[model samples]
Target chain A: MKTLQNFLFELCGEQLPSGFERMSTGAKELLAPLVDECYTDRSGNIVGYRRAALANAKKVMVEAHLDEIGLMVTKIDDNGFLHFTNLAGFSPEILPATSVTVRGVRPLPGVVATLPPHLLSPEEQKKPLPMDKMVIDIGYSAARARELVRVGDPIVLRQSCADLLNHRVCGKALDNRAGVAVILNALNDLVKMPLPVNLYVVFSAGEEFNGFGARHAAWEIAPDEALVIDVTHGASAQTPKNKAFPLGGGVMIGVAPVLNGEVTACLLDLAARNQIPYGREAMSGRTGTNSDGIAVSRAGVPVGLASIPLRYMHSGCEVVDLADMQACSRLIGRYVMQGGAVHYE
Target chain B: MIDAIRELAGVSGVSGNERNISEYIKGQILPYVDKVYEDSLGNLVAVRRGEGSRVMLMAHMDQIGLVASFVDDKGFVRVAPVGHVDPKTTVGRPVVFENGETGVFICGSKEKKEPELKDCYVDIGAADRAEALRRVEIGQTASFLSNTFETGRKIVSGALDNRAGCYCLMETLRRVKNNSCELYAVFTVQEEVGLRGAKVSGFEIAPDVAIAVDVTLSGDHPDARETTAVLGGGAAVKICDRSAICSRGIIEDLENLAARRGIPVQRDVLASGGTDIGSVQLLGKGVQVGGVSIPVRYCHSAVEMADKNDIEAVIGLLTAYLEK
Candidate 1:
């Protein structure tokens, strides 16, 4: 495995939409040396350990899911347009007018095929395009496309991840890639910074779909405390003040759920101690992260969730601030090194 | 527009207690209005001179509420609802008495499954009816009780149905410019019941145009339609409703005005319900009428929501419309 020196753009996998298989490969490569050892389970989650990295240390699991949400090639019509069944939750309204690529025998670029305005009935234009009525045009004939495309082949959208008006970068596959980046950076920093606890950096997988990877990782490496880092909504003028996090603001520490109180407190304390400008990740219920699986793992593990605010989350071309990533990396690594002991009531 | 919503939501004007809300509007709008007076019914009226075309813009000050009708020997007072209320929301809700005594709302028939008005009662910290009378009168109308708190941004989750409209007008007064015709911004009372405040205020202002500012439902939540305007989509301009069809020219003018200027606007033909414009139209000579609506989610609940951006958008459009 190539040790990626620059954390910038190492290919998690050479191909696209192969979700967990690709993402877990990226995570274990980062974890290979930092832990006692690392391995991928059947579900494709890469779990690594530095068992008892410290004396009588609290066993803590830090997870950032490694899967990216995408579509699956269900059918390819002769005109080369591909019909897809969503591998994850996605609204069809936003699906139209977006570019996508199919990963098969060969990678092919395509546009989602939408009905021509002139051909549509008067009623259709006035309403949103419903799901199942949409298609992707790969611009190929049915026979040639079918030979190249399989039933379960993954498809990825081509959303450019670049800086926007501010320091905001727009890109596709950010949901867990941002989380993957956080885990990689933290693992590298672990060697430089000794810790008071056993830190098992888990790059969980399949969270975008059924959370299969997270569940498998939870059972395989059950830790006392789990800290799952994922992306939440970032600020836009359209975003409500209460429900948004600004891009430049540091990582958002989840506090509202109360399941991860100790971990959240530790993250907050570390951020404050380290002079990190952090924000609150307030949600009323489950964080909808791998933390959800890790929270109820075994006899119900207590969990904390830290979120990197990304604009247009789950949607392609999600935007995140690099400052948030750096801050999250610093906060998690330092907190783990300081105290691994957790006493939850 | 912000002022109307803030003032309306912040005040405790549930019903008969609208006196304080009425007093606030009277004070703020008295000087700017052409002729200002309070009706025998306590509805406040402010008339800016109307010349070629008259206009009456209304916001109801009162909300669905309970009136303390009887006090039990244990100081538990039986109350009556003054307007349309979901018996469901009132159960377990906190309410304040006329004398500032706070109590939890409970139903006498918890086992019955469905509670009628007689089954619900308000318990104050008192020993008897004689003592309860000192704090609450029989005619004491208590409006929907909701405290304003900020969870994020500013979330004031109670009783904003018409108060938001009232705030819209108050902001209009603070920002509207240019006066070709008379503009009547009336803070009417009892609109939740039968648009009573507008009935009298309209007769008094009797301008050619009538517009009501109030809350409209925003169905843009998860699983909501894209056509459903969101809290942040912008101000809703009423083109027609069950009560009345908005004048075509007025609708076109506002639409053109919004397009000419960069204001976010959504067109609405309310599937049901009526605004104070209905009462305003019926008051004397019918008035050319329209409305500016705030798209809010959960209109009657503690978490009623409107987008700050949409509120600001309405403010921009109103300023432009009033300026000339």
Candidate 2:
């Protein structure tokens, strides 16, 4: 017996600057064969739904954002240089000399320009150049560059996912794309089995900016419960151990006042009963993910968060453990299949 | 008021781990209110039934502290701040976990120019990771050692930034009798991290008029940031802070009430910092929000200082307003 498989999984176009529609379309094409129903909403959220076999059953949604931190061209200089501002929070120290793709009239490759040490004053050399002072050089004359690129163009870091030591990988926009991968992997497992509840999968958009996508989707779906999957800081030598989780430490479950206590407890119990490795994140307030917006949606939804540990977030070379991704997917899949319950007062 | 402040200050209630303080506040205000209950977010909401306007008075019960994130093989416990923690105040200070396990904060090394949170660790006196694990598990929160003492007329203690606020609210609950309005005295959680508990409680209660009782920065200190509020200057009627603005109507109403009652009051326009007023203001359909701030010095540190006279002024004004 095939269980209800009503899920919406939206893949945001690449980086919100270039290849956004194209990448979203690619994700749809890849996921089209897996779901019973697939569609995109006005907010550009990809939705897939698998109906439960039981006539009356609870609805559960799992969401991950698709947008990545990027830059927007603010001005074009006469010397064929482009000045841009960050679309999201970015460390200035990591911007210099990084490769970027400008989604101008056509995709153009550019490099974040840096002043040579010989030209910099001692004081200027001591600090990283501020975003306003940094420029992108695409090797074009003023007239030629103006013809191809204009102000307000979106720029994305030019990097692709690459394998690392063990079952790890690093790439650009892994802060949330890795979350999308987790949903995709979980869907694969759920599609083959009968699910206990109706599932809605959302690949939300604009989480890095305003969380508009998740907010709209949550209002429309009005699910009984939701699980927001995103990235948390991974443990690193430079980061405090308490502020970050281990790379291969499975999934990080959030404990916050904003989240539903029952849902959080259920997720933890499922992890232990299933023998899936998991860690706890003590968030005093606001999970700072799509869960925040989703929790406060129409009449308020009981929301839970399962985060994948990521290192170097918002940077081009973000790293994540594939094992953790798998574990997150398994935990979500198990929670949904076991008929997750949340009391709505 | 001083006794309540000392009592609440001596309890450990860090953000996301506020059950102990929630229970304490519930027991303290139960007899005065008609009904007392806890919301899903652990907000202790005590309601005194009345037929007049629904009014909510919020005071956050949570304080800033550290959460155990990682433990090393050598028994060093790595921690992350649950709220805005100054690393300078954390160094060489004592902390107590929820289970009463104690530890001393230490910096990683002296090599770094400016020590960041990453360069800090807590020595729990465990010989190794196994022993440390037995004492404190990951995800548990620990607050600065709770201590309250008086020097002359000034009271200094940890968690006073909010416990003082709690004390003021409790004193109001006791003295305020036969009010016309439906009074909701909410002891909220997680204000140090963000105004989270009030956000949910505000949404649920939907109070017509909401006021937060919290500590405001006192510029009376020699090295303090410039602020209009000062110690022993009486209760500060907040004009505005970073998180919220006191509605003009509420300000006028409070001023007129204070003047009529002959209770001295100070106007507070804090340069920075936030309280639960912002959350209550934005709750469903909006609420006319204001704050009664107790002037506090060295906020978020172990030894937060407040004047006894200022505490009494707050208790007097709130009791008058509620009983009016």
- For each candidate, what is the lDDT? 0.70, 0.82
lDDT (10s digit) by residue, model 1, range B160-204: 676766766777777765656677677878887877777777766
Q: Give DockQ per model, in order.
A: 0.01, 0.02
Please state the error at residue B291 of candidate 1 in Å: 57
Each candidate: how many clashes?
A: 20, 19
User: What is candidate 1's DockQ?
Assistant: 0.01
Least accurate 10 contiguous residues by lDDT in model 1 chain A:
A11-20
Task: Report how far off residue B261 is in candidate 2 (Å).
Answer: 1.1
Give the alpha carbon lDDT tens digit for every residue of B1-324 in model 2: 556777888788999999999898888888898999999999999999988899999999998899999999999999999999898766888999999999998888798877788889899999989999999999999988857889889999888878999998988999887777899999998888889999999989988888999999987789665455788888999866657545546777887899998887887766468889777664543467789989988887888999898888888888887877
Chain B TM-score, one value per candidate, order as shown: 0.88, 0.97
Candidate with the greatest lDDT versus the true structure: 2
Model 2 ranges off by over 4 Å: A1-345
Candidate 2, which CAPRI tier? Answer: incorrect
Per-model TM against the reference: 0.49, 0.52
